[model samples]
Target: MDLQRQIRNGWFFFLKHIFNPLTRRIARTSFGPFAIVRHVGRRSGKQYETPIIVSPAKDGFVIELTYGPDVDWHKNVLAANGCTVVWHGKEFAVDKPEPLDTETGRAAFPPPQQLVLNLLGRKHFEKLTCKKDE
Candidate 1:
């Protein structure tokens, strides 16, 4: 396998087995860029909570698609048409998850984060709009 693909697979294994579990322990309460995304599996109907980095937007939030748009959590949110996000110790009902272009996605993050993401070759992002009170 190519170095990039190997690295990607290794990273995925690490994230799934190590990082995600550790992150979940503190993700919901930690006052950092991380947040917990609550979504239900489309096929199994099982509930899942994933740790993710989120940047606040005008009326919602921006999420970097580090593992690309095909990741289970992203696919679940898309299939369900919405998901709840636990950010800064508060639960937010967000919907309308739409893909964003690289430039537009990068613009949502701070310069430092944008630079890091660019360096990591992350180009996909999704914008989740906050559900409005009726």
Candidate 2:
């Protein structure tokens, strides 16, 4: 893994880190309530799960604004359109990803999540794109 990804993963999973759940509480719940997302990985096709604030995309839901490319989950969804997510313990289908331009496009998150991203980070990729996560 790359250095930045290593650092991010360590801080995220390690309970001792200050930026762990303590500092990132808002991120974990930034979207009012978490929405489960299921996507495969670019390198590994195994299913991965992540929770994030989401909003409507065309007719279906979108996690973040854009999908595709460097974001592993997005790429996975692009390669495989069908995903199953358990929400409230009920499984639901998430359509295959449809790519969007990161710049000059609608943010796919709801207002609450947009506020969270605006206060936290400015990266369009991070705010709009989904990553390979577990």
Candidate 3:
């Protein structure tokens, strides 16, 4: 395998087995920019909670697609048209998952997060609207 693919695979494995478990514990807390996204598998019918960095927007939240838009979690959210986000110790039902322009998505985050994301070469982002009470 090419070195780049090998490295990416290794990093994914590390994140799945080590980083995610440790981060999941605090991602849903009322501090920091971390959040937990609860979604179900599209094919497996299994539930999952993924830790991610979330930035609140005027109407909802902007999520950086660190692994790009084709990632399983993103696909699942799109397929279901929504998911639950645990942020700042509160659960929010979000819907209308859609892709955002690079500039718009980056603008949702603070300067620090934008800098980090830029450094990581992240250009894709998804927006989820807060579900209004009926």
Candidate 4:
């Protein structure tokens, strides 16, 4: 494999209790009180799972993705349509991994990425290959 791909493959397979913990602080909200997820690399098919922030939606939950595109879980979320999630120590079926253009996520995210979210609205990220789909 190419050096970059080899390095990334080795690196991504192992996340820690520090980075991909069961719970982590997100903007001081202790957001795991809200959401979490379990997914894998889309192209590599390596297994991975982690906690994240989420909001209730219809019969499922909507995740405000922070890691941005090019990450495994984000790509996995899109591929699986509804990735497995655990919230507040409980598991739930998460559907529609939407990128919401909330005041916070929009402004905090990169300008180019924010524009895509603004244009796509919500629930479309699940179907996108990347932000370019918008």
Candidate 5:
């Protein structure tokens, strides 16, 4: 495998096996802007909910790709074409998972978040739009 792919996989392993468990526990509450994405496994047909930090955009929300686009949940969302997101004490049917360039993605959020994204090397993002009445 390529070196970049290997590094990404290693980071994913740590997040999946370590960070995710702790984040999952804290994501259930309204402590912050944390959201939960409910999606099904592409190959396994298993349901999974993942915690994510999101900021509202004009027509949807911008999901920070902290771990890049290789993560399982991001792939699952793409494969499924849609998913349910629990955010800000409500559930939203989010669709249209599109990866935006760094400039476009950073423009979706406010100044503080944009600065943080830049600092974190988060150039990948998913633009999800809510489906009405879902």
Candidate 6:
């Protein structure tokens, strides 16, 4: 692996295995814009709950790729065709995870969120449309 990927993986290991525990507990209560996306593994057949930061979008939600788009949760969501996201005191079954460019993706966020994304160098984002209730 390249140095950049190695660095990213090291940070990911810390975030997913260590820091996420604290974030998960706080995120579960609907505080902030944190969400728990429940998705199954593509190959392992394991269920995983990944905490992410999201913002309300036109029809669904916009998620910034904090650790970049190569993360496993995003891949899992893509492979599974959808995932359930618990956000802002409600659970939403969202599909159609469309990848967007920095301009379009950042447009979905408020000023504060947009500023943060800019500072973080986040260029890719996903727009997941909420599935309507039957």
TM-score of 5: 0.79
Q: In terms of lDDT, which candidate is stronger, 1 or 3?
A: 1
TM-score of each: 0.87, 0.51, 0.90, 0.49, 0.79, 0.85
Number of the candidate with higher lDDT, 3 or 5: 3
Clashing pairs in 4: none
| lDDT (Cα, tens digit) per residue for candidate 4, span 1-134 | 89999888776555453455434444224343345566777777777665554544445554555455566667687787756666555556555455544664445445665576578663222221111112
Question: For each candidate, C-alpha RMSD in Å?
Answer: 2.6, 7.6, 1.8, 9.5, 3.6, 2.8
Candidate 1 residue-wise lDDT, 7-94, digit = tens: 9999989989999987776767756678889999999999999998789999999998777888888889989999999888889999
Give the per-residue lDDT of model 2 (tens digit) for 1-134.
Answer: 99999997886577345522342354344334345566777577577764544454544555553222465555666677656544345455765655444432236655666667667653343222332344
Model 6: per-residue lDDT, tens digit, 1-134? 99999999999799878889877777789677688899999999999988888888888999887878788888999998999988866789999599888899888888888898889888888898999889
Is 4 or 5 the stronger prediction by TM-score?
Answer: 5
Please name the candidate that would achieve the greatest lDDT relative to the true structure.
Answer: 1
Give every collision pair in model 2.
65-128, 81-96
Error of 3 at 117 (Å): 1.3
Off by over 4 Å in 3: 1-8
User: Candidate 3: worst 10 consecutive residues by lDDT?
Assistant: 23-32
Residue 1 of model 4: what lDDT? 81
TM-score of 4: 0.49
Q: Which stretches of candidate 6 lie over 4 Å from their true place?
A: 1-13
Residue 42 displacement (Å), model 2: 6.1
